[model samples]
Target: MKIKFFRTIWWKLLVSYLCLILITTVISYILTTATFRTIRIKERQMEIEIRVERIARIIGELCKEDEKIENIKGNFNEIARISGIPLQMLNPEGKVVAFSRSSHPKFRQIKNINLQPFEMRKLREGKKFSYTQYYGENRKKLYYYICPIYREGNFKGSLVTAVPLGLSRGFAIMLLNSVLIATIIAFILAVFLSRSFTRPIRRMGEAAQSMAHGDFTKKMKLSRKDELGFLADAFDEMSSQLKRNIESRMKLMGDISHDLSTPLTTIQAIAEAICDGVIDTEEGRKKYLESILNQTRRLSFLINDITELSKFEAGEVKINKTLFDVVEPIQRAVESAGFLAGKKEIQIEISIEDEKLQALGDMEKILKAIQNLINNAVQHNPPGTKIRISATKEKEKVLFSVEDNGQGIPEEEIENIFNRFHKVDKARTSGASRSGLGLAIVEEILKAHGEEISVTSSQQGSRFFFYLPYLDPASADVFLDK
Candidate 1:
């Protein structure tokens, strides 16, 4: 059940934070307890040393065998009371001679828990100046300390002090109450912190979901200058761009429909006029009918291009890969543009040196892309200008390009000309080009075949370029078998 955490970043962040806090708390607890115990032991032992030293000084001048030892024994209890600890004194023979406590709690069994007699005898032979131990005879918890006493350069007795291992009742209650208060305060702060961190994330997530559902109207909210804020701003920019594209496509579709309808209406009206004898002469009627027919053909061509573009963009178009000669197809495309070239008095030329230059790709789409580029060059060229188409085998790829010595594209619209239904200006297009789907259709088809296409235009002229996979002699023959 614990193995499924790789699904997202937030879960990992929460787990990482939990682990880091727990590890830090454990280390802090260990270090704090060690320091506190060392401090407590040192404080208790310092007071014991002072008491033993004073007693040694008082009894140091006493001559032979005085019974003041009883008075001195009572002083041990006074030291324990003043220092907030219990005292157990052992003779040099290691017997438990005395013990003192004001009151014992009900949970304690005082009499059954005592120090071992033999353990004290080894300590009193002028052995340890001071030491400490925990636990008692009945296995109850205690902290026992031993200190040897001296008088006139002879061993008098030993002091065994035992402090309860548990905290005092009042202190224990106070610490527990403090912990409860701290926990409540920390939990409230934690809630506020969690909200501060997750609120921006939630807002970003909702905006993303709306974009996924094709509603690009909403923008992400951002409040900070961190990575999240940068991400939010980027997302907002993406949404604005997407909204503009969607609106443009809708407007273009309406324009395309109107263009096609107007052409068809002209053709229909011309046919009706000819049938009704509205034109008195046959020659006049024939010319009007031919003009209407030309517009009808243009509408048909535009519809076919739009359909191909949709298939390509939707990834529904299939590529039939085969080895084919690149030079002949390019020549054919230029020849097809001869009429437009003649009308503008522009010369169309094709240059190729590699007769065996072969490319593996869909020949039909390649032909269409070249045709569109040539048509663009022809339509946009001034009189007496020249356009050229060329192909060459470069390493593993076949490169094709169409170049025109024309007024070239404007600096601003060169990159955007391939976008769906985008045009630089209304005055610069053919009569039917308010739809503006030419370059977009060309780009989509080439892209579907895993090919690259681009255009560059400057004062030197404009070049439209693309590439296809080059196949050698043996590989080209192998393709012919399939």
Candidate 2:
């Protein structure tokens, strides 16, 4: 999708970077210019003071002989020419005595230089002073430095020097130009840097769009170790999970439809045949009715299994855990499956490490799980095969195992045996009445109890086992209320 320039991350980042650079540039320029001006002014003041002191000394020497002020006009003019600054000699009364010649028109117009009251006071005290004043219509600044002249322990007149206030205009222009160049360079870099930073995000956005369209194959190939890379990895994982779930859901729907439709079609056909009087004999009619009844029962069982599995998957099934004798459930499950085992001519053997061993879990669910495992062994094995059911205490847990000496499950199918509607090869076993949901129910029940079931199979037989925390009866009082 096309995104607006102003709303994009690149735009925001670029604007932020440029704004920072602009603010920094402006602040740096103001500070640097101010500092440069202060240093230049101080240097100029020192230079002017040195030159004014020399002129004061010259005036003092000339005045020892009581020479007139006009006689030293030539000296003042020469000093002004050499220093490129205007000069004025002031009497003790703060009036101009002798002034220098200058090429500048503004300085030539000056008839007299007046000193402030403070300046006069400082000079009267035989101290030097300096200050700044603006002149003319433009208000141009000029720096003034005055040195007191002394002769024979008496205060002579003061020597004054005046120069315009500023640094070199060429250097100032160069400094400003340098700052502008740097700002332009930084702005250019901000564009590239913002683009580099936002490139991965744009790619991820596109990948998300593809996912929205039901395409889960997009991969973000980013290798960075930053947060963005971590997000990309998570996104990739989510996509893979979504793909797997979608595929599994489709397969499950197909399995359910097939399983349900087979019995439904059979029941429908048989009912129609009986209604049409295809079997009018008493024995034939009774036989067809029995078949219909069996199909109906199969349908009911399938529906119930699907509903219960859904409850488990949706986390709607709460495990009501309590301490219960593990042996009681084992015996109950074996007895419940005795009729089915008898029909298959299978023999069940039970082995208990301790009859009093108790496990912590919902007793009803645990018994149901055990019953499913025992029935699965009976239904999947050949006639006359032997099944061993056992509960043994090891460490702090009770291990329940069921092993059947029948044609074992194939190695490749072992991993998927617990999946819903998954069945083994029919030609290798005898029973065909199972709905293939028994192992799946067992797995979900154990999982809800915070336990896992594992199976090991060889040419001899297959053994399914799981562990539950064993509860000591002495400590069972604490959990009795739960």
Candidate 3:
């Protein structure tokens, strides 16, 4: 599908990356400019100080030769023009004895020179002095360096030099051009990175669309080890699980229709046969009526099992837990299935490690789970098969097991035995009442109690076992009182 530009993750990631880069570039530009400006100003101040000292030494030499200021004024103007800085000759009394003429407009506006008291005192003491001041409408910075000129070991005067620290127009343009070029390069890189970041998300969206249309074959070929890779792996797992569930549901529907149709067709046929007088004799009629009744009962059992499994899968079945002697339910379940086992000549052996072993769970459900397991063994196995039922105390829990010595389950079919409507022996026609939901329901009952059931099978026999939390009789009473 063609996604809207602004609504896609690619567009959003691109915008976010560009915004971050832009902000970083602007901040970097401002800080860099400020830092370079400060360094340049310091360098200029140092250079001007050296020049002022040179002029001071020259003036001292001129004083030794001639104390008259006119003799040195021509040299001062020459030095100022060469250095492009204005110079002033100040006496000890803070008066400008001579000053250089400059072509610069700002220097021309200087009518008189007034030194600060501290600066004059330092010069009189034969030491150097320096200060900075701002001038004009733009507040341009000007640096002043004053060094003492000495003649015959006595302080004669001081020489001053003034230079502006304003940054040049050419330098400012160069910095701005560098920043613009860097920003363009950064934005281009951001575009590629954004595309790489959003590529997986786009593929996942396409995969989801394919899944919606019942196609489950698409795979994301990302091989990254980051969070995006983890998310992609999770997506693939979800898709696989969804496909399996859909296939399982389809199989379950077919199995249910087949199971229900058999009993229903038999009941319909028997009823119609009796109605059409096909069996006129009383004995034949009675036998046909009994067959119809049996079919109806089988239909009822299948519907009830299906409903019970639906409730368990939907989490509609609530477990009402209480502490009860585990052996009581085991014994009761065995006795209830005694009639069926006797009919099939299946021998059931009970082995209880402790008759007083107590477990915490819904007693009725536990009984039903045991009964289903026992009945399953009897119906599936041939006559004379022996089923062993055992309950034993194991540390903090009680282990219950049912083992039958018969043709064991195939290894490949063991994994699917707990799935609803899955029968190990698909060709068996003797167990007409079996709806194939017994093991599935048994599994659900144990799961609702926060336990798991496991099976191990060999050619000799198959054993199904599960554990339940055990409680002593004294503790059971204490719990009931609370």
TM-score of each: 0.66, 0.86, 0.82
Which residue runs of candidate 3 sit more than 4 Å off their true CA positions?
Answer: 1-26, 59-67, 72-81, 88-102, 111-133, 145-160, 271-284, 325-331, 347-359, 386-405, 410-412, 454-463
Candidate 3 residues 122-150, lDDT tens each? 78888897777788898988777788888
Residue range 1-482, candidate 2, lDDT tens digits: 99999999999999999999999999999999989988998887888788778878877776764655556667767766786667778777787777777634555565477788988888878889877778879787777778887776567678777778776789799999999999999999999999989999999999999999999888897898999999999989988999999999999999999888988898899989988989889999999888888888888888888998999989999999988888889999999889988988899999997778888999999998888888888877789999999989989999999999988889999988988888876443223346778889989999999899999998788899999988788878876765
lDDT of 1 at 403: 93
* Per-model CA lDDT versus the true structure: 0.69, 0.84, 0.84
- What's the residue-level lDDT of 259 in candidate 2? 86
Model 1 accuracy (lDDT, Cα)? 0.69
Superposition error at 360 for model 2 (Å)? 1.6
Query: Model 1 clash pairs?
Result: none
Better of 2 and 3 by TM-score: 2
lDDT for 430 in candidate 2 is 22
Give residue 9's lDDT in candidate 1 (0 to 100): 47
